[model samples]
Structures are given as structure tokens and as C-alpha cells.
Target: MSDSTTLVYKKKKKKFKIFPLVNAIFFIIVACLIMIPIYRVIISSIDANTSYNFVWLPSKFTWGGYTAVLTRSSLYTPFLISVVTTIIGTFVGLLVVTLGGYVLIQWEMPGRNFFAYMLLFTMIFDGGMIPKYLVIKQLGLMNTLWAVILPMSINVYNLVLMRNFFEGIPESLFEAAQIDGCSPMGIFFKIVLPLSKAALASIGLMFAVSFWNDYTNFKLYITKNKLFNFQIQLRNMVIDSDIPVDDAVNQETIGNAATIIAILPFMIIYPFCQKYFVQGVNVGAVKE
Candidate 1:
């Protein structure tokens, strides 16, 4: 090649080496590294005892684990309980957080900063388990689904994210709505909310994941076996080895399967909202 052509090729190569392509490759590598264990868990769940040893690939695959856990496992009741709790908790928590966040951002209500600071304080410092338990007891919520939902209804960090999103909306739109004699509630429902779909979906998914993965609350307040969440059931399965096996329950493989099943919903839902999640994170990271 001519010297000039060689020099031009070297310049282009240098520019390519400095591009974000390197960072993207690095990110993919790190992501795959993190996901390997999760992938293994899913694989293990689909296979039977062939996975007992540390083989990288399963020699045989079966639906036994899923069938065992979903149909015949003793913990099926708890799985149902978890589904109910997650649904109820996510719905209630999302409504409360979004509505409260919207109000706090909009009204400039008296003592708003104090309330916000108090909420932020909770993020840093928690009432210890005992105190929180006592309060739940005092409220007569123990052994009830409300016990799970009420104490954690509004996460301060999530509220802050939602507030930032609300703040990002054009104030002029709100003003125009006000001139049309729209009430705060009407404006929130009709105008602000439609525009804030991305933020809401992101926050809702976060809350759903939190509620789904939570075992501590259920373990603490729900003494009744019927009230145990899926995490609690999985914990019990992992701890006890001699659990009964029926025609549908492959007791030997249920733990691994349960772990996979527990995480599958989040895996399915996250991709759909991933764009919104990134946007929400970037927007929330910036202080208004």
C-alpha cells in the first residue's frame, strides 16, 4: 500500500479504537459474566438430577422441576400467596407512590421539605425490625396482607424519582390546564400522567420487583404457613432436604426450579421497560 493510504488507514483505526464500541464490548462482557449464574439457575431448573454435579451443560432436560413446584409441591400454597402478595403490594405501592409523589411535587404544600427530608431520612435509617414489627402489631396488621403492603407502600427513593419526573413536565401545560378550570386531581389523571408513562412504567417495574423479591417482611409478620411468599417457600425448600415428593413434585429439583421461576417474571417484564428504565434513571439522576 502507498504511504498515504497506510497513514489514512492507521488514522481511521485509531479513531475506531477510541470509539464507544470498546465500552459497549466491555459492557456486554460484564453483563454476560453477571448473567452466567442466572442462566445456570434457569438451566438447572429445567433439568433433573443430572444437574446435581457441576457440569457446564445438562446431559438431560426435563420439565420435572417446574411441574413439581407449580403443581404438586407442598409449597404451592405459598407460591399462590406470593403471587397474591406481589400483585396486591405492587398495585397498592405504585398508586400510593405515584399519587403522593405527584402531590408533593405539585402543591408546594406546607412542610413539604420537612416531609421530603423525613422520607429521605427513612432511606438512610430504618426503624429496626422490632420497632417496625411493633408498629405493625399496634396497627393490628400482623398476619394480614396489609402488614406487607402498608409499611412499605412508599419508598422514598422511588418517590424522589417520580417527583423528579413530574418536575420535568412543562409547567406551562399545567398552567394551561389550570386556566381550563381543571382540578389538581383532574390534571394529574388527564394531563401529567399520560406524559409521564415512561417514568411510571419504570417505577412500577421497580416496585413490582421489590415486592416480588421480598421475603423479610413475610418471614417477620406472616407466621402462618398459608401466608408465606414465594421467597419464603424457596428458603424453606433450600433449608429442608427431605421434603415430600409426589407424582408431580420432584422434591429433589424444586429448589433450583423455584429460584428460576421466581426470577422469570422480572426477566420477562424488564426488557419491555428497559428503555424507560434507562431514561428514568438518567432523568432522576439529574437534580432539578
Candidate 2:
């Protein structure tokens, strides 16, 4: 009886995915394109010899550029100002994005759409630069860190991203939280926030970068030289030739060094936040 019927089974085949491999190669090329420029900047900063042309490797190396930037009194104040503004601006920006986003998601709340449309309207049109200046002047924020911080604190784009993320959260979770006698603030702190790590990191990074690299707002509102941030100091050093230079380092060298200092923080920071960052940007892109 066994000999009469022979069982047949087909062997499973392994499929090679060209898309993933192609994606890897594409990303590798992209990464090198990004990293090469950074490598050049770092090498240029360390290179003691003065030359405008880009070099793959430095002929001579020295730390004089970094030392000059770090030790110079002119650069120090601006650098500190940049750091302080970035920290305060990021915290305040997070508060604005989170609260405004949460408030907009409350469907039962009165005038929610009207309030949201008002915020969106500002994105399409705004009071001109003179009026903005007049308003800042009237508020007595001129020449202060707040002048820079407050202008950037309320970004409509970030608020919208956050609102989208909030909308993606299940309505069931909110209902359950309300059933447990959780107030609005309680649900925000205990439930909403715990689910929003990715959004916070991504938006926080955006705010940090914006405030850290801010140039126009500071240059506009801050007429006083003492209030300038590091970018301004770098501009004066590199472009305007306002700051005094040390004999040990060339102006270009100091500029490159300062450039490294300016971008280095984000380079270090981004890798730590990479996982959350990818998720955060794509938060509302897909549906389950």
C-alpha cells in the first residue's frame, strides 16, 4: 500500500530582494556625500597651512584654530548666548507645540477650528518686517534673548505636525483615561506624553537647530553687539573682519574651526535620536 503512493514536495526557494540591496547602496552613496563635506571641514579646521582649495588630507595639523575660537573673549560670549537661547527656545517651543496641538485635537472644544485656522492664516501672510519690529520694540524685547526666543517659539509647521500625531492616537485611549477620572491635564501628562517620545525628539531637534543657528532674527532685533550669537561672531570674524585675530591662527582657520563647533553638536546628537527621528517624521504618513 505504501509503495503505491509516493508523496512529492517542492523545495522552497530563497528570493534575493534587489530593492533592499539597491536601497543600501543608494543610502551608502548618500552617506558618503554627506560625510565627505564634514570630513573636509574638520580637516580644514585642523590644517595649519592656509589654502582655499579643498584637500583630502591636511599637510600640516594644529589645534591652534580650535584654541583660538574656544579661548577668544569675543567668540565666547556669543557662543554662550547661542547655547542659552537654544535651551530656552527648545523648551518653550515644545510647550507651545504640545499644548497647541493638544488643544486643537479636542473636537468638543468651542471654536477649535477657528483658532486653528487663525494660526494657519499667519503662515500664509504676516505683518511686514517693520510691523514685526515695531511689535517687538513695543514689547520691550528688543536687544534681549527673548527677542530671538519669542519670535521662533511658535512655529505653525511644528504645531501642525504635532496635531497630526495627536490625531493619530486612538480615541479609545482617551475615553478609557476619562473613565478613570483623569482630567485633561492628567491625561496629557500621564498618557499622551508617554506615547509621544518620538514626536518630542524630532520637534525638539528642529527647535534646537533653529535656535542654535539663528542669524536673521538676532541680527535684526539685537542691535547691541553684546547680544550677538555665535553665528554673528563667526560672520564678523570670517566676513566682516571685525574681531581681532591671533597671529597663531589665520581667519579662515578660525572660521572653519567655528563651523565645526557649530555643526558638531547636531552630528553627535542626531545618531542618538535617529530611531525616534525616522518614526517621528513619518508619524501621520500611514494608517493601520
Candidate 3:
């Protein structure tokens, strides 16, 4: 074959690959699977007709379910408690992870390898529920908001992600800060922390969502309903048959409405941080 013809044939063969199409098809199917359940919940939430409709769309729509959930005073307290605990937990978790990440990347820090190995060890094998409970009880944190906040304070995976991002920062910057008479603490607070916002934001979002959705902690450590967070409260409403029926909608409709309410905040907030989240995840994902 002529060289020009061979090049064109080769280019054509390279351009027409099945991988992209296969990937696209796979994602589309997965997307449909995810969306269908969400769609059903939404439809069911708004449907107040009190009749079973297996159709794609609801025959009638009403806001009774939403009103039923929103007007309840019991739901309001847990919502506020969740907001407080999530904010506190996310801030504390992020702070600890960021500092730990910084320390992990420091070559001269003594026992760094040992600590890193210990961190990894916890991720692989944790003290079981009974042990954790005993520790909490010993700390006198049981039945308090701190019980939930402190146990999940630092996720090892997030710490590792932050460490990876810190490793990617230029060593020259740290050296320059030291030359300017800046202590390691000052460098971390001013230079390192400021530069690590992308990783911090990404991990912060993860921590916030985790703290927001934590029901097991509340169920296990917190017996007092007044101290419960929104998810735990919602769990009780759903499973305990304790939801008030005096509202316009039935129990099932209210549960669907509660589900949407619970998930709506994350859905609304995710798009705003999505770019930073993706950037952080990708930036730390590789190493030289």
C-alpha cells in the first residue's frame, strides 16, 4: 500500500474504537437505574390520591406530604440538631485530616511511617462495636452530640487523600517559608492550608455528608430522642410507626416526602462543590 493510504487507513482504524461506546452505554444504563428509584420517590411523595398507581407519572399531585412533614415540631428539633452536629463534625474532621495530612508529608517528622501504618491498619481492622462503645462510655460521651462527632472525627481514607495532595506541593515553597523564619506551624497554617483548599473542600463535603447521614451512631450511642439527629428521627418515623396521621397524607406518603427532604440538601449543595471535588480527587490520584 502507498504510505499516504496506509496512514489514512490506520487513522480510521484507531478512531473507531468500541470502548467509548461501551462505556457510554454502561453509564447510561446505570444512570437510568439510579434515576428510576428517585423518580418513583418523587412521584410517590407528591401523590395524595390515596390509590395505588403503578404508572410512570402520578395521576394527581399535592403538597400534603410536604406540609405533613414540615409542620411537625418533632422533625424541626432533629433537623436543627443535625445541622449543628454536621457543621461541627465537618469542621473538626477537616481540621484534623488537613493537619494530619500535612504532618504525613513532612519527611523529617519522627515516627511518620509508624503513624501512617497505624492509620492504614485502622482502615483494615477496627475495634468492633463493643470496644468502640466501651471507649465512648469511658469518655462519658454517650447520649451526647459529642458521641457522634468524635468517633468518626478523622477518616483514614480522607487523611491519605489529603496527604497525597500535600505531597504534590513543591518542596521549594516549604523551604522558602523556613528561610523567612516561618515555623512549620506557621507554614502549614498560612501556606499549606491556603493552598490545599481544593482537597479540603472535597474532603469537607465528604465529612459533612457523612455526619449528616449518620444514623447508626445515633441509634447505638444516643437513646434520648431529644438528642437525635434528623436521619435518626426520620428512621424512627419510618420504622416505628410513630408518624402522626392527623395530617392530610398517609404514613407512606409522608415517609416518601421525608426521604426527599433528607436527600434534597446534598443534591442542592453537590453541584456547587462538584468542580472542586473532581479537581481534588484527580489531582491527588497520581504521583511521579
Per-residue lDDT of candidate 2, residues 1-288 (tens digit): 353343222224456789999999999999999988888888889888757887998877888888877766788888889999999999999999999999999999999999999999999998889998999999999989999998899899999999999888888999999999999999999988898999999999999999999999998999988989988888877787654566666777777888988888888999999999988987656543
- The TM-scores, one per candidate, come to 0.84, 0.88, 0.92
Q: Say which candidate scores most in lDDT.
A: 2
* Alpha-carbon shift of residue 214 in model 1 (angstroms): 1.4
Clashing pairs in 2: none
lDDT of 1 by residue, 80-113 (tens): 7777877887788778878878877855589888
All models: lDDT?
Answer: 0.78, 0.87, 0.87
Better of 2 and 3 by lDDT: 2
Better of 2 and 3 by TM-score: 3
Q: Tell me which of candidates 1 and 2 scores higher on TM-score.
A: 2
lDDT score, candidate 1, position 245: 60
